[model samples]
Target: MKLYPIEAGNFKLDGGAMFGVVPKSIWNRTNPADANNMIDLTARCLLIENGDRLILIDTGMGTKQSEKFFSYYYQWGDHSLDRSLKKYGFHRDDITDVFMTHLHFDHCGGSVQWNKDRTGYEPAFKNAIFWTNEAHWEWATKPNEREKASFLTENLLPMKESGQLRFITRNENNFIEKSELDFGILFVDGHTDKQMLPHITYQNKTLVFVADLLPTAGHIPLPYVMGYDTRPLLTLSEKAQFLETAVKNDYYLFMEHDAHNQICTLQTTEKGVRLKEIHTFDHLFD
Candidate 1:
């Protein structure tokens, strides 16, 4: 199996929102904020070439939204999904499976795009089966008030409408030994509902695509949870359990939201689990 780091795009989010109740004095040291209090973030998607199935995890926020809608996020950089795919000699049509960690716009937005006629939206990857669990599919479709803004209809619906949507059979435990996509899936609910984190064994090491469960290396601490999370207390518990397991197994966490750091590992420090090391995708994978 071969792994490629796909740079979907970069944008900035409010540091306060990203770090939750954690005071700026603390988080600012690591994720320094801009004059407007926005912190740098990236939609770092992952592409796995396993045999004939080229699976893509998360598709970043697409370019279909209006300028006014995108101005809120303050997007930056020229890195795009097509450019990144071409870097690996691939294209969106080449993807066979699109495994979404969640239905948040930033994660799954790129799955659908405006059709050529501009009449309506359609599945971006014409050949890919968009993947999400039945539970999340329901939750996102009928989103609560707090998360309604993040779950845009334009970013969803089209996949199901296109008849390319499918769900993974979920297990009762927080971790699935092996998902239909041929990798372990760690299901956590603190962020939204049933966010699936992929635990892939590649090149003799375990690399976990830590979605919002651990957005950045600065979020390694137990108390550092995102304000967007519906259940912060549950997040604390989930992070505690995951961090302990990650440390024990020496897993490489593939961070999806951190613009500066791509992959990180944890260590058992006096202050609990802390960042042990940081690695760029090429530095470690290549």
Candidate 2:
């Protein structure tokens, strides 16, 4: 099996929103903010190639929103989903599965795109089965007031409409173990309902797609949770337990939002789990 880091694009968000209760003096040291107080964030996705299946985790924010809508996020960078796929000698249609961690606009917006005529939207990965759990699917479809803005219809409805949506439920043992992929799913609810993280075992190493649970190495400290999380206290507990498990297993965290740091290892310190080392994906995998 081979894994590739796909760069969908970069955007900016309010640093205060991203850091939640953490003071600017602390988070700013790691993720410095711009003059507008927005921090740089990347919609970095992951691609896995195994046998006949090519799976893409998360699609980043697509380019189908109105200019006024996009004006809010302040997106920048030339990196694009299409361009990233082409970098790996593949195309959008070549993906066999799209495993969405959640249905937030930044995470799954690229799953659907505007059709040729712009009359309607369609599944961006023409031949891929879009994967999400039943709980998350329902939560995103009928979003609450706080999360409604993040779960846009244009980013989700088209997959089901295209007859390519599939639910990744637990097996008899209450674990997601797909024999095709060299990984298992770890479901957490702190960030959103049933957010799935892929715990992949490759080349005698366990590399986890951290997703929003641990957006960057800076988030390693227990209290550095995102304000966007629906339940902050629950996030604290989840992070504590997950960090302990990550340390026990000596896992490599594949960060999705950290623009400068791609992968990091954890070490148990007096202050709890902290980043031990940082390495590029190619530096470690290649």
Best by TM-score: 1
Q: Distance from true position, residue 124, model 1, in Å?
A: 0.3
TM-score of each: 0.99, 0.97
Q: Candidate 2's C-alpha lDDT?
A: 0.90
Per-candidate clash tally: 0, 0
- Tens-digit per-residue lDDT, 76-151, candidate 1: 9999999999999998999999999999999999999999999999999999999999999999999999999999
Model 2 error, position 63 (Å): 0.9
Candidate 1 regions with alpha-carbon error over 4 angstroms: none
**Could you say which candidate leads in lDDT?**
1
